[model samples]
Target chain A: MREVAAAERRRRTARLLVHGALAIASAATLFPLVWMLAAAFTPNDLILARPFRLWPEQATLANFAAASEAYPIWRWLWNSLLAAAAVTAGKLALSLPAAYAFARGRHRWRDAAFGFVIVTMAFPTVMVIVPTYLAVVRLGLVDTLPALIVPSIPYIGFYVFFFRQAMKALPPEMFEAASLDGAGFLRQFVDIALPNVAHVVPALAAFAFLGAWNIFLWGQLTLASVENKTLAVGVALFSDIEGAQSSWGPLMAVNSLAILPVLVVFLVARRSIERAFANR
Target chain B: MRGAHGGSLQTAGLVAPAFFAVAVFLYLPIAASGLLAVLDYHPATRAFSYAGLANIEAVWRDPAFRVAAWNTLVYCLVLVPAQVVVPLLLALGLREIAGSRLAPVYYACLFAPTLVSFSVAGAVWLPLLNPINGVLNEMLIAIGLPPSRWHTDARAALWVVCVVTFWKTFGLNLVLWYAALMTIPREQIEAARIDGAGFFRRVRDIDIPLASPTAFFILVTTVFTTLDDIVGIIDVLTGGGPFERTTNLPYLLWQKGLVFFQFGQASVVALVTIAIVALLTFVQFRFVERRVTYA
Candidate 1:
């Protein structure tokens, strides 16, 4: 009886310990964000006075007002949404067909073709930037939305690889049936292959959306105009303009704004995001 | 098979658009980078001429290039291991608390930063890591410890970049590790427990090997991201500042090509970075992945 009691006590202590550790780690991880959230609502002067306060003594939306007034924050947000949508759509449009081809098409050069795409994933954008930049300049696509969206689409290596895996997992019997019914490759792809991999679409789309939305280096290089910049790039510019002035509240507000859309996207697709990352 | 050639041609047609985009935008640029590495560019006249190995020699001789190379090496060495092991440890901790009411909440909080852009992340940390009025310094002072310069200090700048980058990115690997852990059979663990396997023993003997493939995935992706993705955070936070202490190869390329218009030098750096990536990837797949015991 005493041994049973002692083991129960030990288990309880271990559980408590685990929970406590997780709580602390989570808090530490969240401190900066939570602080940003608090500061975003608090008045600018109060943020400086009460740096450690987790709650705003007097909350206001003026910081967001200031952010919008100072720079084209709304425009930046719109640009971000437009670019992310375009890039995600472009990636899917390009990748889905390519992935289907790789998974189902049995040809001598298929592996080599896939290899060519996959290898580009390993090469960093900086490696290709000089020539890509020159090409863009030559085409006069600088500061255009197409420049932002078009070049960004080709780095679909992981998407193709992932979609291929998803496609490969689908039962071959369906494809065989479709083939027996006189379906060509394109027909099989659109009618059968896409539907089977529908579950993976939201996850991939979320990832592509997040990736395109958060694009900094490419956006920075291509989007020269203030209005053309995405939220991520604009926030950096906003910080540069406001950072030295120590305008914490408005900056935090804009920072919070930058996180909101992705946060919504993330929440909506949380399970899918987790599943996508979980894949081997 | 009937119409096999025709079917193959259809497949080729389907793949052509993506292939064309990749070929023109990606491969052409890569090929051009190699050539550019060996050629000199006149920014004013927009002229390119073959310069032999001078670009390579110049890149090799530059102190900033050397510093960038060293910082990149340090980044890979430190961040790669930390990115792997820390997430694994956190994932294990998370695994312990899995299925609890708070598990999802814990995950959401940890992953929240990752969903934010690097620029926003940098912006979020800027105030927190600020020297005087920053919350971090405030906390330190409240605890009776002396506050220190975080990202502004040359010695601490790279480490700050490391921390911010790690913070913004580690959750992806954590999820991967957690998923890997969840896939491990509970029966195997229970049997091991019955056979008197201790926690460390079970982790070492079973969990580690079973999760090897995920570990390998995390390691490769982490290395590439540590090299590639942190450029934004670096651009925002330090701008490779405190006397260029935090400059990595990617940042160096950015500064050289775009900021300084030294395209030739940037191309050299690009080639070197690509070679490193290719070598690392080849070595990982060729050697390390061979031993991964996939379930």
Candidate 2:
């Protein structure tokens, strides 16, 4: 009886320790983001105040107001949305047919071509930026949305490879049966393969949207005009060019605003995002 | 057979638009980069001449390129182990927790930063790490230590970049590690436990070996991705400042090509970066393939 009681106590102690450690780690992981949000609302004077408070004594919208006035936040957001949407749509439109072919079709050059696509995935985007910039400049696409959209299309190759992997896991018998019914390859892809990979669409779209939204190096280099600038470039406008001094309140406020869309998409589609990452 | 052959052709034909698009958009540019690397090309002159090995020789001799490569190597060496090991440990530690409710919450917090842009993260961390009026400095003062200039100080700047990049992506490593951990059969662990193995022993003997494949996957991918994907961090954070200590090859490539208009040098650097990544990836696949056993 005494031994049983001792064993129960040990089990309880282990459980307590596990819970404590998890709580601590989770808090540490979340502290930066939570602190960012907290500091954003804290009065500008108290933001750097010692013994950072979890909750601010006084809150103000002044930071946000300043950010809005200092930059074209709304316009940047709209441009980002439009560009991201176009990129995502173009990725799907271009990648779907390619992925279907890679998955179902047999050809002599298919493996070679697919290998080429996968190899490009490993090449750093920065390496290609110079040539791509030259191409855009030659085409007179610099400073236009087309410059952004055109470069983005290449990235869809990764998505094509991803979708093809997913499609390959589907039963081949279904495709064969569909083809037996006289449905052309395009029709079969549209009627059959499209519906089956519906789950992946949201996941791919989320990935593409985040990539487009967070795109900075390209946006900063290519888009010279403020009107063409995405939110990332727009947010970057807060830093003083000569001194590198940034307005603390407006900078944090705009930074928070910049991340809000992606955060929303992530929260709404958390499950899909989880699946997308988990699959690989 | 004829019908099947025709169908295959039709499928290939259907896929042609995407194939052509990817080739024209992605592969062609990359190929062009290779050709440009060997040529004396200038955007201003709109002229190109064969430079033979000149660009390659210049890049090989460049001090900045050497520093960037060294920094990238150091970053990868420090980051890859921490990213793979810490997350695996955390995930393993979480396995003993009783309630399932806390798992999702733990994962949510861990995964949150992965979704945020590195640029925004950099912007957010900048104020937090500011020297005088920054919170980090204030905390140091509270602890009775001197204030440290994080981004401005050359010695500390690369580490600051490292920390931010790690924070942004560690959650992803955590998630991947967690999923891989879940796949380790309970029986294998329990059997080890039954055989008088302690927790550490079980982890060392059973878990680590089982998780090696996943670790290898994460390691190679992270190394290549970090070498390539850290453009956002560099662009936003220090702008490769404080004497360009934080500039990786990717950032250097951008700076030389676009900012300095040194196309020949940039192309050489780009080609070198690609070659290094390709070599590393090939080596990793060869080494890992022999050890990775998928059931």
Candidate 3:
């Protein structure tokens, strides 16, 4: 009885130790971000005040107001949304069909062609940026949002890879049965394959949406105009443009705005995020 | 003979659009980079002349490129191992409390930083690390410790970048590690415990071996991301400043190409970095992955 009790006591202490460590680790990981969100609401003068805060002592919308007045902060947000949404839509439209074909289609070069696309997943972004930027410049699309969106859509390598995995997992009999039912290739893909993998779509879409939303370098390179900048690029340059202590609240507010959309999607789709990485 | 369905024409039709997009944006640019590496551009004529290996030689001899290359080496050496191991350690801890009431909360808090953009990651850390007005030093002083410059100091800037990058990225690997850990059959672990395998012994013999494939995956990705993913962090936080002490190859490529308009030099840097990454990734898959499965 004493041994059992001692063992139980040891387990309890170990559990307590683990819990304490994780609590501190989690809090330290979140401190800067939570402080950013908090400072976004704190008045400008007190944002830099000592003792650090995870909550606004006196909350106000003045920071948002100031950020919007100085830069096209709202417009940048809209632009970010427009570009990210289009990019996500384009990724799904392009990748799903290709993934469907790769999974169901059998041709001589099918695997080879799929391999060709898969290879792009390994190409570092740096290798392609200089030339892609030059191409966009040649086409007179620099300083435009389309320059950002159109170039990024081709990064469907991972999307195609993931969706192909999802499709391959579906029973082959389903596709065969659909074909026997006189469902054509397009109809089979749409009517049979699409609905089954529909559960995976939202998760992949959320992941893609977050990726597009957080694009920084491409946006910085392409979008030159103040208003044309997305929230990420614009807000990254916020301090450079507004060189004053007063810019702190507004900068934090805009930075908070930049991360909010991705954060919400992430929290809601947390399980899916895990599954997405797990399956990959 | 059960064959996967669809004719060549059908496959062609479905795959063409995506292939076309990738061909234009991805393939064409890759080809262009190769061409630009060997070609010289004159703004006066807006034309390219074949310069052979001149661009490569120029960028090869550059003192700044040399510094950037060395810094990148340092980053990979330090970050690649840390990136792989730290998350696995965290996952082990989380596993201890896997089903507790606060597991999800702790998981979410660690991951929240990952959801932020790399540039915003720098912005997020700036307020807390800002030299004069930052709260970190305030807390340090409060604890009776001498305050230190964070990113502004050349000696510490690269380490700061590594820490931030690791903090932001380790979460995904954590998710991966957690998933891999959850897959190990509970019976095997319990059976080992019955045989008197202690915690460290169980982790070493059972957990690490079981999770090796995921470890390999995390290793390759950490190598790739360590080289490229921190460009935004470098750009925003330090701008590779303090005399370019923190500039990696990718950041240097960006600065040279767009910022300095030296396209040829930038393409060379891009090619060099790409070669290093490709070789490293290939070596892992060839040798490391082979042992991972066989051993």
Scored by CA lDDT, what does every candidate get?
Answer: 0.86, 0.77, 0.85
lDDT of 3 by residue, A122-224 (tens): 8777889998888888899999889999888888998898899899999989888888788877788898889998877878888788878878888889999
**TM-scores for candidates 1 onward, in order:** 0.96, 0.92, 0.96
- Tens digit of per-residue lDDT, candidate 2, span A139-195: 888899878876876776678788888888888777778778877666777877888
DockQ for candidate 2, C-alpha atoms: 0.53
**DockQ ranking from best candidate downward:** 3, 1, 2
Backbone N/Cα/C clashes per model: 0, 0, 0
- How do the candidates rank by TM-score, highest first? 1, 3, 2
Q: Candidate 3: where is the Cα deviation over 4 Å?
A: A243-246, A274-280, B1-4
What's the TM for model 3? 0.96
Q: What does chain B score (TM) in every candidate?
A: 0.95, 0.91, 0.94
Model 2 ranges off by over 4 Å: A1-15, A48-51, A176-184, A240-246, A276-280, B1-6, B204-213
Which is better, 2 or 3, measured by DockQ? 3
Tell me how far the alpha carbon of residue B95 in candidate 1 is from the true structure, in angstroms, after superposition. Answer: 1.7
